[model samples]
Target: GTYRAFVDQLPRLDALGVTAIELLPVHQTDPQEGSYWGYMPLCFGAVHAQYAAGDDPAAELAALVAAAHELDIEVWLDVVVNHTTEVDAAGPTYHLRGLDDAMYRRRGDGSYIETTGCGNDVDADHPAAQDLVVWSLDRLADLGVDGFRFDLAAVLSRSPSMMSRLEAWARTRDVRTIAEAWDAAGGYQVGRTWPGTGWMQWNDRFRNDVRSFLRADDGSAALMEQRVQGSPDLFDAPGDSINYLSCHDGFTLYDVFAYDAKHNGANGHGNRDGADDNRSWNCGWEGDDGAPDTVLALRRRQLRNAWCLLAMSHGVPMVAAGDEHGRTQGGNNNAYNQDNATSWIDYARRDEFADLEHFVTGLLALRARHAVLTQPEWWGDALTFLDRRGVDGSTAGPSIGWSVGDLCVLANAWWHPTEFALPPGSWTMAVDTNQADLLDPPTPVDASAYVVGPRSAVILTR
Candidate 1:
């Protein structure tokens, strides 16, 4: 899709109540390489010509940013500064490889060190490479880009000075920076180990634990509680964690409930490309095609429960595009090569899954109504984690309850219903994932206890 076409969709995103939109790599890539994901950067300073409808790609990108800002949405661009399309010695020579071989990391024999799984790794430790990255970011900031999400940021973190230099540059422009915090290789740095200070890290721990709890895995309730408390076990502040259920790389939220295993045969990799452990439950039947109505209803309830958990969590929530409307890729998790219907956001699903879309919108609105969900600091003494009986302790069962200020959230991951004892004041129900519609009319609850549905969540406010 062209930048103008993307501009037309900003209003729909605004209606979803998102404060920011992060686009995949917009940097120029080699047209001959046939890369659909744009992870292989050909030039850091140029915009991909295919994404622009007008003659000037830079101008069109600026226009896109302007349109998003008009809708009160901040635009964040994903940047790939780790590797390029120039693979190895036999690969095509781009500007950097042709000009200076020192741009890449090399061994004693002068062969490339492939830490990125892309055949070669950029030597971000080099001063010239650091200068090039800052220069490119400055050019992007000049065009009104609000922030950047670094792909494979662990590669850059390998250098002692690269992150510090980038931070110094970002401070002058007042732009935000986010880190993926891991590389294709085993360079894992998720929390304070990541070099960038004051930068948000994608909390994959939150994603995995939430998915495990949704599928009713053993010992997931304690992990889910840690994630719901903004992952105090991982990060220093709530804003340091960017919580998400799915992203461009993983299964869509709908597919998480519809498919047990990846159907990536279309990627031409023999269905062996995507991650093997997806932590997904098929809800008694795989693939939604001839599933019974009872299974379908359960799937919808599962989706709502996932969204409710994400929205109620005390970190910055991120929703993948097309996830709000039940978009499916035929169970293709690694769709990096298929640019056809498999990757495209089918707008028709908006009408097909209108109820889900409405539910997502309502959940976001409910999140906005509560500041405790997105606040920067920790919950500290104000929040109390409890069991279903309202006793304070580590939640070890399938049922968990928590009270923070005026709000109480109860979640039951069992196959049968569970009753949760309430705290002091009279409570009214604001959300229940079992119901198709949100609480259009708030329902008051009993003074002492409330029964939560099986494999669902409920929220009460006094």
Candidate 2:
């Protein structure tokens, strides 16, 4: 099937340490606009024929799964049950509208509900709608998928019973379920609710908070504190959020710090299609330039801050592809239509952005090395800290602390650099996010305090 070609890329992804593959909406979609992001769906039962492996689509899916299972990589299908691509009376009439238009969608005097603003929002409150969603999921479960990423998941919660039933059904199979838990009307909450029993969410709070911190905006530190801790304020559990600085919808991470205003002239929209309230600071220039060293240093630091937060945060961190190499859309935050070189990964510029890539690799490695960073648990007294002045090797508390066996993380987000006293014994520096020379020899500092660079992170192990 056509999907075999897509599955063939798994080995390369696996080589890069990608443990999971989040497939973008495999469901049938509009053949007209083509629904590039896969948010617009046409059918829940059928896989998009365009993405199928070959003539026999089901066989291709099975082969893809077998290959992925052999490599120990989990597949997460992107499912869009919120709305169908068949919108308006003039659009293509698909399964939902064809079966029972009145029951499948919410209507106000024969007009469809405009909640998703994609012409029509599915009336998930109806039993038929819920059945279709559950049936689609069951089909995927039988296909041996490891998980699902629900598109526009808040719409499901509009009918609590439907959400609850879906959750119960999902628990029967061993699979991860994630929800895009944000709504345009701000009706959705990130924590456990109707559909969030074992479901995680795309943490918009993490994105906004981290963006603010990278831009050095006012009150950013307070917002960042929540994001760093996995946004406990939003989620009931620690792992119920996906921390990301950039994704397919927003500006690329590099563009976030490089362009204050979006240049979307290439998209034929005259910059009207993208967001204007981007909390971005371009260091000095609005776009790319042969800038001076000082400007370059500032831009690098900003990138480092965002990357470090994503790596250190207590959630399933998702790095947008090419973010490691500082890929930019030439300041076009929304490049859904410009499927040219602007959106594709440029292998030639890998060396140009090598430093950023190395920084990200190092940060992720550091995170993987520390169980305290990833062990989905809420902060408590066990996660204690010791200040530089109080590092007497005592169990006494300082200001910050996290425990995972013999490893501990201590951060001083203060403006000035401070000394962190290590316990008496040999302690290795697993990672120093601030220092360029990550493999530099470990210096034997006073047991009373080791100097931590200003606004830096240090991973210490005894």
Candidate 3:
């Protein structure tokens, strides 16, 4: 979509109550490369020309940023300084590679290092390389971008001085920074190892554990409890985690319950490109095609359940585009090549999954209203984990419940209903995923225990 088209969606996004918008690598990609996802940056200073409806891509991008700021939404751009479009020895020689071979990491034999799995990794230790990255950051900040998400940022950790330079730049700009926190070469620096102070990280552990727990995987309940509390064991506090279930890389929220395997033949990799361990459950059905209405309804409920978990979690929740409205990639998790309808968002789905859209909107609004959900610190003494019977100190079952201060979330992943004992107080039910209008007017629960529907979540506030 063009920058103008993206700006048009800001009103709807603002109404959905998102505080920030994270755009995938907008840096211009080589036209000859034909990469759908612009991760392979041709030049960091240039905006992808195809993303602009007008001739001046930089102006269009600036306008988009200004419009988002009008609504008080920060624009976080994803950047790829880890590697470039000029991949390996056989690849095209773009700016850096053509100018100096040492710009890329090389072995003693002069073979390129493949830390990012992109054939070549940028040598962050090189003086010229560091200059290039810092200069790009300055230019991008001048474009009015508020923050950045560094793709495969663990590569930067290898050069501590370069990482320091980046941290200094971010401090000077007073902007937020996030890291993918790992590289293809098994460099996983998730928590404090991520080096950047005040920088957040994409917590894949939350994604995996939550998916496994919802799908009733064995021994997933305890992990779910930890992730729901913002992955305290991994990070120092809640704000350190950019908790997400699905992103641009893998399955969308809809696909998480609609497919069991990666259908990436469309990616032209013989169905072997994307991750096989998707941790997805198809709710007793494979593809959506010819699926019975019963399965479809169950999938919708599961989708809502996922959203409920994300909204109630104690950290920043990342919602992938079109996920609130049941967007699917036809099971093609890696649809980078298919830039056609498989990857394009169909707004018509918004009406089809209107209930889900409403649910997401209300759920996010609910999170926005509750400071407990966004608090940067751990729940500490204010948190309590309960079992299916609502007994404290036991959450190793298909059902789980947790409360922080006045807010409580009870998730039942079982096929049967679950009885949850509410904490002592007059409680109001703010969300019940079983209902068609998930955020319908709150109802007063005059009981000591509430029965959550099969595979649904109930949020209560006292």
Ranking by TM-score: 3, 1, 2
| Model 2 lDDT at residue 381 | 52
Per-residue lDDT tens digits of candidate 2, residues 195-257? 557788888778887777555455665665567677777778777888887888778888887
Residues 100-142 of candidate 1: C-alpha lDDT, one tens digit per residue: 8899999999999888878888899998898889999889999
TM-score of each: 0.97, 0.86, 0.97
In the range 265-309, model 3's lDDT, one tens digit per residue, is 877778989889999999989999899999999999899899999
In model 1, the runs with Cα more than 4 Å from the true position are 389-397
Candidates 1 and 2: which is better by TM-score?
1
| lDDT comparison, 1 vs 2, better candidate | 1
Give the lowest summed-lDDT range of ten residues in model 2. 394-403
